[model samples]
Each structure stands twice: as C-alpha cells, then as structure tokens.
Target: MSLSHEIMKNICGYSRAKYSTWFYYRPDHILFDAGEGVSLALRNMIYGIDHIFISHNHGDHIGGLPGLIKSRASSMGDITKPLSIYYPEKDSQILQFKEYLDVSIPKLPFVLTWKGLRPGDQISLNANRFVEAFASDHMGTLSLGYKIIEKRKRLKSEYKGLPQQELIACIKDLGREAIHEEYHKNLLVYSGDTMPLDVSIVQNAEVLLHDATFVLGSDREENTHATVEEACELAIKAQVACLALFHFSSRYSHQQVKDKIYEIITANNVEIPIHYIYPHFYPSDFKQIQIEN
Candidate 1:
C-alpha cells in the first residue's frame, strides 16, 4: 500500500462542528483534541495514547479528558503508564478542565503531566520525529494547529550527481553531516477549529486534517470555521498529498455534505485524494469517505 493509505488506516476520529472534534493517530499514539465520547469510542485503545494535544479550551474539544483519564486509571489497561498533555499556553479554559480532572479523579494511578505550549513550541516524539505547534485563527479563543514533522538527511546540493564510489569516499572523508543536509518533512497537519489556514503552515504535508464546518460559504454567519471549498482550496495550494476534512456542522445532511465536497473537487480539478467524516455517522461507525482522486 502507498504510504498515505497506510497512514489513513491508522487514523480514526469523529468531528461535528459544535458538538465534538477529535483524532487518534495510532502510529504515534497521539490524540488531537479529546472531544466528547472519545473515551467510549477509543475504549481499550485509550491505553495506547502517549500524548494529547489540545488546540483550544472549548468544551466540545476538551469534554472527553475526564473520561479518558478516568478510564485509563480504572480500566483493564496498564494503570501506571505516563500520559502527557500539551495545549496552547495559558489557555484558561484548558486550565479549568485540568482543575475538573483534579477534583474528579484525585487519586489517579498514572503520572499525568500537562504542559503549556506556544505557537513555535515543539515536543519530541522520538529522535527524528516531533510535533510542532502553530497559531490558528479561531476566534474567541487562543487556538493552535499542529504539525507532525520528521527530520531527514539528504545529500547536500554540492554533492548531488556524484558517482556512487566517489560519494562513498566523500562520505568517509567528510563525515555524514558534512556532506548531508537535514530537512523537515511534514507528515501530517491538523487545523483544530480554525478558519482557513495559511498555506505556509501546512505546505507539502502528506496528510492534512482541516476544519470544514460549512457546506457553503453563505451558510457561515461567523468566520470561526472554514467552509468545505475553502478547506479544499487551501489543501490544493499547500500541495498536501491527502486531505481529510473534519469538524463539519451537524446541520447538513450526509448527502448534502458529500455532494458539496464532490462539487468542490470537480470544480477545482483537485488531484489529491480527499476524505471527510460525515457528521451524522455514529462514533463507533465512524469511517471517512475517501473521494477518488
């Protein structure tokens, strides 16, 4: 299978604009925005999560924390595993959620840590991969987006086109770093509850999960969330290999949502694969439709 397809199979989540929004990226054991029903949806898989990244403090985005934490403590999973949570710096709403967890689960068995982060802050997932935060334009809150970046080494510009034997000799003489340059590849990007993001933030990502809360631009009474077309446009401009739109408003029917996305894809001649979570689908039945490229 293609790398993008393999990555898609590992991700599962549910999103409804005003109700809930969350994503569980299995490969990294990272949960983005623990929304309502997260614990129930994830069930035993809750034990696999090593980190939770909160975009903002909206209740819909953080309501699942208490359940998730409590379940990990009381459920059949390993109770001593450490769990870390990262969120936008000084978000009062998230602080309130933490306080609630403290009161609700005072005697937790695990070592839970919460750290505040800024837009440029980065948390290492491993030696070569890390999660980086970036600002997002979600009104009424200090929202942020996240990028999963992988650090890779490549031959320096001057060393390109050299014969294989010559390259080996050069590598031995100059050492690896001297002949190589490091570049960051964006594996995935999640724009949590935001309007259309700046292209630069999600450029060239293998996958982009963006907010698409409105089927039509005219349906938006407020500019808090992006419309489906806007999200697709941004994905195209950013050159993302795959786009998975979530956080759709519950007002639209499944057919309406699918039709609108199809219209956008056809009208723009979008070549990259597009996927979306139908808001009406139950969490247990949650499966994104991968629109043909």
Candidate 2:
C-alpha cells in the first residue's frame, strides 16, 4: 500500500547491522534520514519529499544523498520542487559529501539547499506543526533525535465547569482567547540510532520510532544503540500511543526478534502497542506488522 494516503503510516528503509537506515513520514513530506537504497526503494514517491533530515554523518545514515539528488533531477517526476537537507552542524562527513555533490552534479534541474542544525533547533513545517531536534547518545558522534509538534487550542480549566449557553455567551462576548489556551502536542518522536536516554523527551507522544539494534543486553555496546528491552521501557515510561522499533541487528532472525520483544512486553506488562520492522525487508504498510500488546 502507498503510504501517502495514510496520515499516520510511515515508510522505512533500514537493514540493521548494515549500511542503511531511514524513515519517511509521508504526511509531512519529511524524510528522517537518507540511507542507501532509499531513492530506489521509494521510487516516484521520493518526489513528494520536500525536507530531508539527517540524524548524523554516519555512512549508513547518509550514503544515499547523491543518488536521491540525481534521481530527483533527472527522473520523470517534477523537477522544480525545492529540496532542503538538514544535518548536524560541523559534521565533517556531511560537509565533504555536500562538496562532492556540488562538484559531481554541478547543474541540477531543481534547487537543493543545505542547513546545519544544532541540538534544540526547531524547523517550522507550517503554521501549526514543527520539528525539533534533540541530542541523542550515539557513541559521541553528534547524533540527534527529532520530535514532531503540533500547536493546538484547548478549553481552559475554568471553562469546563461552565454551561454550554454560558460558554457560547462567553465566547461571543469575551472572544476565544479568554476561554482557551494554546498548547503544543508531541505527535511523533524518532530516536535515530541512539542508546536509551530520558523518557521525558518523548512523553505523551502519539507514536515513537526508536532504535532497537540489539535484542540482548549482553550484545549492546557501550553508549551505542539500544536493545529491544530498552526501547520497550522507554515507550512504557513515556506512555506513548504506539512504539515502532527498527534497526534490528542482522545477527538475529525475525523469529528471534519477535520472541524477544514478546518476552520483554510480557515480563514488563507493557500496554502500548509495539511494532517492528524486520531486518532486510521493506514493509509497504507499517501498521500491518504491529505485535499485539
């Protein structure tokens, strides 16, 4: 199924313990990373992407930039759409890659812009939605995580006790500003290749796509990727609506990964729905593979 039609569906291009990792949030036209084979896997759907956010300069995270750029320029899709790429500030590898693409594809059919992002940087998607970057623990490689926030207005606590007629009269006489408060809601959080960190960063999120590169804690490396158990704990602690785990280690079979996740959820009594992307497989629909709570 095409992910573009579903507002909550996500597209993933990842092969754990391999050379590629990426997630495409179709509703926002935002791509979390540009890992290898991303352009090929997405095909024409790539034309819809207007913003590409790179978590870090790791080869597995950014190896597909050149191909994606070239395809957008030369393919049968619209060539006039502007593409903006955001990466960590002062990332040597990304800087080098930018220079390389400049020299290799000197003349492109569309405009390509690059921005350096720092921790806590926010990029506005529209008037109501925006994306914020946060520092992630990934072997000290200057990695970052992203959160999608939406601005919303809610009725003030005092207004909740008022009758409907009173509320309508208040709105008519005092205006909405007097009875409502604007707040930001966390829609989705993507933990790009990071070890488990504070759960508060992703509290109350609608969905969380986290790194689960290892199934066993014994297999986890110091300050690197998170294991399945860690991802589950964070999701449960944060009370997220759903957790989608990706970046599984290639050493484990699909059955092994599923078994471990079930074991963890059962042991901890986690109530949130948990989903996983099988290693080496490209899932067309994200919701189909969710494991029962």
Indicate which candidate wins on lDDT.
Answer: 1
Name the lDDT value of residue 126 in candidate 1: 97
Query: What's model 2's lDDT at 279?
Result: 69
What is the lDDT, from 0 to 100, of the residue 268 in candidate 2? 82
* Model 1 stretches astray by more than 4 angstroms: 284-293
Model 1, 202-281: lDDT tens per residue? Answer: 99999998998999899888879999999999999999998888888888888888898888877878888888888777
Which RMSD values do the candidates have, in order? 1.6, 2.7
Model 1: colliding residue pairs: none
Candidate 1 — what's its lDDT? 0.89
lDDT of each: 0.89, 0.84
lDDT string for model 2 (10-92, tens) is 55455555678888887789999888888998999889999999999888889889899999998989988999999988898
Please state the error at residue 68 of candidate 2 in Å: 0.4
Q: Which stretch of 10 consecutive residues in model 1 shows the poorest summed lDDT?
A: 284-293
- In candidate 2, stretches whose alpha carbon ends up further than 4 angstroms from where it belongs are 1-8, 283-293
Model 1, position 148, has a per-residue lDDT of 94
